[model samples]
Target: MELLKVSGVNKAFGGLKALNDVNLTVNEGTVHAIIGPNGAGKSTLLNCFVGRLIPDTGTVMFADKSLIGLKAHQINQAGVSRVFQTPEIFGELSLLQNVMIPTMAKRDGEFALHAFKRLDKDAEIIDTALHSLEDVGLADKKDVIANSLSRGDKRRLELAMCLVQSPRLLLLDEPTAGMSRADTNNTIDLLKRIGEDHNITKVVIEHDMHVVFSLATTVSVLAQGTVICEGKPQDIKGDPRVQEAYLGGAHL
Candidate 1:
């Protein structure tokens, strides 16, 4: 079953086209990756799906609903969530509190004012936030200030916050951007577990080949504002065109 369908999507700035006639499909409950060199339109394509940029043409459909015209928050409400390259968290807030804000917003639809209130009155919300933290193996650090955590833990905390929303489609941009080898492996393990345990569909935009090959069941390569190739990871790994256009070039 297809969970996301994007067809003939085009976006341009002045004279340069960032994305041109791009079409992509993500099946339900699978990890699909979009990869390419630095200048590729990978991030632009993601922005289109999440409503950060409105496409010049074509349509984006998620769970059978048209997503082209919706605002970013409306897109989230429509069951799509995104994690950026940079971790977005409240540095002064406790890790659990960070997760609680989104969880409550998803449930009660107000995050700003409610975040200041004591969470002790909402036992269910607190429990849900704890469970989300546990899913990313950060339950013990729940009370720690977000800024004090290591870089990897901050990434994990961000993931935990996103999970608390229970989004159907999770969009991740450079999820493992900076981390030690051990932390990278741990993140890979967590993503694998999440993919198995939940029915969530993931679309990741990353430059790390190791990360891409490890988690992506299917891969798509973009170059110069267009999709160059797409298939299983193994197929993409060996494709001569991919090697010449991306890997074999001086860049990698």
Candidate 2:
């Protein structure tokens, strides 16, 4: 039931080796979190998964299908969606309209803005958007401009955008990076609800231990471009290698 796998992955920039001989496997329908210090190559491994970076020698597989040579749009079309560190949304559009855009995207990377459907069909699209909005707790603000939303709401809007695609695997990079405690906890609840409601597999790169422990079913700890340890929440907490990874460095 492994949904994604990375084996023998290596990445470097000039003289700096970001990832070295790394291997990982993510099971279906679980939140797998990758955590490490600032320079542990956590993001480097994420890029390998999403086609943003190709490793020097490795296999990146989603459902056993290779992803190394695919383009970003191609990766997205393959049912892998990513939520960036920042909220990526249209500031000028209403929340509903913003959600409508991705639902209108064709698999070939073109936006079918003018492919007007029948009235009933368009109405169905609207209903879909509304339901997605409700899923993210934004149904009441469907008509509000995206920019007017608070920081947490903006993040929720981004989640709604991704959900509209019905992605089988969702990758999140620091989903709670810049939120207050209440917002962060709320986002955790939202993600938990999302997992239960949608049955989506999630791969998250996170620095917040609270968020990681709250949502992750499995945790991988990386240090100096290699995974030093990996285990369940309780196991990772008491791991001496995990302790060493953060003892002399910055928090993760």
Candidate 3:
């Protein structure tokens, strides 16, 4: 089944066409990779999905519901979670406390239960947060300050934060960005585990070909604001259109 449907999407900044009649469909429980060189409007398309940007002319449907005008929190509540290119976490909070934020999140985007206050009322949230930490391989660091962790650990924490929300759709922007090869491979293993454990559908926007080929079940190559080719991993690897999109050549 199609989990997401984006049709006739277009975005422009002044005369610059960021997205031009772009269309994409993501199947449920599949890791769909959106790849391109820089300035191909991948970010803009992701923003549109999460309500950060409203397309000039298009319909983005999640489970057949129109998502064009929903607020970010509302979209999040509707089971769409985004992991930004850079990890975003509370620097002063402990790892466990940070993971609890999404679980304790009120509808209006506030924490109804304070981290220190109402411990009894927060028991369920706290337990879930701890479990999420364990799943992300950060259980031992639960009490450590968020800012003290390495960059890779920070990324894992952010993923844990998103996972606790139980999102049906996870949007990842360069999830392994700036990581050493070991860390990158670790991330691939982590994602593989998550896919096995959850019924989540993923749309990953990544520049790393290794990461894309390793994790993606399907790939869409975009250039000049349009998707020029899309297919399975091996198919995309040999496609002339896909090659030209990334290697500085004319659009297909």
Candidate 4:
């Protein structure tokens, strides 16, 4: 059931160690969250997994393949996709077109420069893109310009774009970074539905305790570059170590 395995991971810059001996395993269909204080190296660890950073030492195995030396695109092709904290959709493009780019790349392996060439000519790719948008409840906004949509809709577009890739594992970095309470709750609901229906494992790095509690089946708390504690949400909520290190002694 383990789809991704990371062991003995370490990354450092100069004399400061960002991640030290970090070990994590993500099963095929579950939501795993990594929570920590501001400087606990959560983003650094995520970069290592998605090929944005090369660790000083570690082994990352995805679907039994070594992912150490692969480039970012190679990692994406190897069935892992990541969504950044900020929405990465192209503001100039329509919502549907933003999703179409990945769909075309997945199928044709290249970004054709001719806008005149209809990407929707491929029935399966178009169908998948539309379904992905529908999953995020943005199917009705397909023709809206990406920049014109609200912040929450932009996040939904980003999710739809990632979903079009059909990645086995999705890495989300604070999917609700700057949003209203209503928007944040909507995102949590979308993530829960995705976990249940898409069959994709998720590794989320979140600072919001509410979001973490709602979406994470398992939580790992990091402090000063190492894991301080890990367990189910209920146990983590009651753990003194987690509370002191990251939750500020509050039962979040």
Candidate 5:
């Protein structure tokens, strides 16, 4: 079943067209990757899905409902969660605390630091957060300050935050933007494990082909804001259009 469907999507900035009648479909329980060169409107398309930017003309359907005008939080509440390029975590808070915020928000529709003092007394939410941290291999550091974590751990922390929400669709924007090869590979394995454990569908916007090929079940090539080609990883690797979209036929 298709979880996300974008049809005739168009967006523009003044006279510059960002996405031009683009269309895409992501099936359920698959890691779908959108790859493109810089300025190809990959981020723009993602914004449309999350309600940061509404498409000038098109329909974005998520699980049979229109996501075109929903607020960011509303979309999040609708089971769509996003991990940004930069790890978005509370630097001053502990790993457990960072995870608990979303857990509270998902249940109560809002969260506040004032309520954090009650975390120790709230076993249910704390257990949920601890399980999320454990899933991301951060349970041992639950008491550590968020800012003190390494980039890889910080990214894992961010994933724990998202996982706490029990999102049905996870959108990852450059999940491994800055990391060593070891960390990158670790993240790949972690994502794979998460998919196997949760069976959640994922949409990844990436520039690194290695990450794309390693994690993506399906690949879509975006060039100048248009989807030029899409297929399985091996098929995309051999597509000439994908090669041309990279750096002038320089082997995709």
Candidate 6:
């Protein structure tokens, strides 16, 4: 049950090749992690899946449908949701209001400021948004302004926003970045619980080995715009190529 597949994908920026013959498969309801050093094309590859960049050649399929040329919103409509490294939230809005926007977008197919005018009258959507906030432990602070939240809380809010969309696949780019160790561990627990509760497939691009080993059932290592090593966590840790990629052969 491959939920997402990338085969022979290639992307280049002028003289620099970002992704070269990259291929990846994410199974349904499992966490697949992509790891690499800086400039290794991890983010570039993610952008391709979400239509931010179209690969120069190859196929990207989601449940057998091609995702190469679809717009970002269209790809999102096809049940793919992305949470960026920086939390993408409506800073001026309340946390609940922030989550509500995506709920409306999921139902109405487009998001507009005018949609919030009708938000109060839509009890079902409000309830759904609240539930999403609760899942991420932000229900109590639902009224807090998004910009006022701490870094960790902002990330949780972003996850809630994505959850309201009921996406079948979630793409997370450095989900626990810029967090304290405590917050990072809490995020790992939250993600594991979300997997148990929602049964959503996740593809994560992360620099944190702890988060990766804790959540990823499968791992892919990219280097110099190519997938150099891929396997289970235990297998990947000992792979010489992965060790070299990260630490110049000193050991991961």
What would the TM-scores of all predictions be? 0.94, 0.93, 0.94, 0.92, 0.95, 0.95
lDDT (10s digit) by residue, model 3, range 92-125: 9999989987877722253344446675466788
Cand. 6 TM to true fold: 0.95
Prediction-by-prediction clash tally: 0, 0, 0, 0, 0, 0
Model 3 weakest 10-residue run by lDDT: 106-115
Q: Tally clashes: model 2.
A: 0
lDDT of 6 by residue, 1-252 (tens): 999999999999998999999989889988999999999999999999999999999999999999999999999999999999999999999999999889988987855567346658889889999999999999999999999999889999999999889899999999999888999999999999999999999999999999999999999999989999989999999998898888893333
Q: Quote model 1's TM-score.
A: 0.94
lDDT of each: 0.89, 0.89, 0.91, 0.88, 0.93, 0.93
Which stretches of model 4 miss by more than 4 angstroms? 110-117, 247-252
**Tens-digit lDDT track of model 2 for 131-174:** 99999989999989999998889999999989888898999999
Angstrom error of the Cα, residue 20, model 4: value is 0.9
Looking at candidate 2, the ten consecutive residues that score lowest on lDDT are 106-115
> What ranges in model 2 sit over 4 Å off?
106-121, 249-252
Off by over 4 Å in 1: 110-118, 247-252
Which residue pairs of candidate 3 clash? none
| Ten-residue region with minimum lDDT total, candidate 5 | 110-119
TM-score of 3: 0.94
Model 6 worst lDDT run, 10 consecutive residues? 110-119
Q: Give the runs in model 6 whose Cα sits over 4 Å from its true position.
A: 111-117, 249-252
